[model samples]
Target: MSLIDLSKHVALGIDIGGTNTKFGVVNHRGEVLEKGNLRTDEYEKVEDFIDALYEKVHPLIEKFGKEKNFDGIGVGAPNGNYYKGTIEQAPNLPWKGVVPFGEMMTAKFGMPCTVTNDANAAAFGEMLFGAARGMKDFIMITLGTGVGSGIVASGKLIYGHDGFAGELGHTIVKPGGRKHWSTGSEGSLEAYASATGIAITAKKMRAEFAESMLNQYPEEEINSKTVHECALKGDPIAIEVFRYTGQKLGEALANFVMFSSPEAILLFGGVIKAGDFILKPAKLHMERNLLPIFRNKVKLVFSELDEADAAILGASALVWEK
Candidate 1:
């Protein structure tokens, strides 16, 4: 009889996005051995998606000496429930209703699986290998197409009873304010803090300033990226869009600071690429809103993980966590 080699351990990490499903083989040290992606929207049925995933992934597992050398599979998906091992009511995904995603993965891959919402997975990754490392309490806020958040307190994620906790983005920051595009919720932080929100702000604000650089692009071409470009060129309207977005974000952060009193708030995703244009305003407003005791106590910073690989690394961190 031969003993298993524990030193060569690895895990399969999968990040399921609305457009693509990225998968990777990751070692304990957070290095991605290899990675690939497939179109997520192509499959209409959950069963077909799982089968396609198996067909594509099985060979990679075999290349790493099959399942014996692997720890397990870790997955991050929209609305994934760690406790229930399901994905329930994810609006962007083709699958409607509750999907037994973790169970299906385990059945197809012949391995144990751990699943969590994409935001939570990113938080776990931050805890294990990114900026939040060595910090027991912190919050991870992803400012992307839509705002997403994960809260960690007392060294653990706050899953609440329903496993749907830590949805800071949906919290209302203003009464009778901007309406969310999909959720239809008015005054939610996501309405003003996401990349979508930034674009919307730019579009509306640009009309008043006829000479604004934003007027150069047609309304359809006006997005967060173009706004950022205009801001780089010292356009006042474009800069104001980021300032307004940051004010909303900072106000929300103030509320978050009071609720959990985290050591830091780590910002991640494309929206943060604007750098100081957004960050300085956010920091200023956050401090202004905070109480004297809570002021200057919480650190606001960017995540240390590489954006391109953060999702994969985050999902892989789940396996190590378990």
Candidate 2:
């Protein structure tokens, strides 16, 4: 074991995703000095997961501490609650319910630890160092398997009454329409706006257009990326799907803007890579739906932060701020 120094100002950032858990050492300037990832499926139990995390991260901390001063640790995960310092009912992880994640990490590393929902963390990362930097009020939306959001109003992350306030994806956009049997819901924003949701919508549209180029891909293997590629190649069906998804998102965003009156709306995640296919239509719809006071007032933008680094930065910002 190497002798560790305590004078360094680096903080550890950890982002736990459905497929992977990423960790990094970052400075106050948001420069990531070291980073790594672990497969989330490798562990069967939460304890096993934590043990593996410690095994991988402890060495980095020791190494960095030997060469520079280091601070604490910050974490971001699905269903994470900052107030409880726990992750409750995360859809991706195998853990059954709430786990004292922050306390467990602190106990293992002997450092201060904090945690927040992945979306909230990303929002904070964006506000502190990414696209939303310098903006006081904004909404950050992550459009992945599901639509996740972080609401910042008056320069603060709104945790609501129970730390579950920013579930923009679950908001109902269409009542008594497009029912999802899994959750017993009808026409949720996520059902149409997320990557999986868009893929489902694209598949349905593909059935109506027998001449669509998307037929090149098997029906069982269609994905958002495939649809985007086809749309970029001028496939009408693919284009329509993008337009529809964006329209739904835009309408939902218009409602959010009315309530929050945010300065900007920042979009992140893989699905947004469709670029103009999604953004242009979303902007048009949002503008069309907005009230006279909000029309043309709020700016819609993309995340400037590196996609791979966002979660880590967000997680690390929690402890770094301390």
Give the number of the best model, judged by TM-score. 1
What lDDT does the true structure give each of the candidates? 0.88, 0.87
Once fitted onto the true fold, the runs of candidate 2 whose alpha carbons sit more than 4 angstroms away are 1-7
On lDDT, the candidate that comes out on top is 1
| 1-322 per-residue lDDT for model 1 (tens digits) | 9975655889888888888898889887788898988889999999999999888888889999664488789888889998998999988899999999999889888899988988888888888788999888999999988888888899898889999998888999998999989999999998988988888899899988999999999989888899999999999999999999999999999999999999999999889999988999999999999999899999999999864366677778788777
lDDT of 2 by residue, 163-235 (tens): 8779998888888867753466899898999888988998999988899988889977788899999998999
* lDDT, model 1: 0.88
Summing lDDT over every window of 10 consecutive residues in candidate 1, give the lowest-scoring window.
306-315
TM-score for each of the candidates: 0.95, 0.95
Native RMSD of candidate 1 (Å): 2.0
How many clashing residue pairs are found in candidate 1? 0
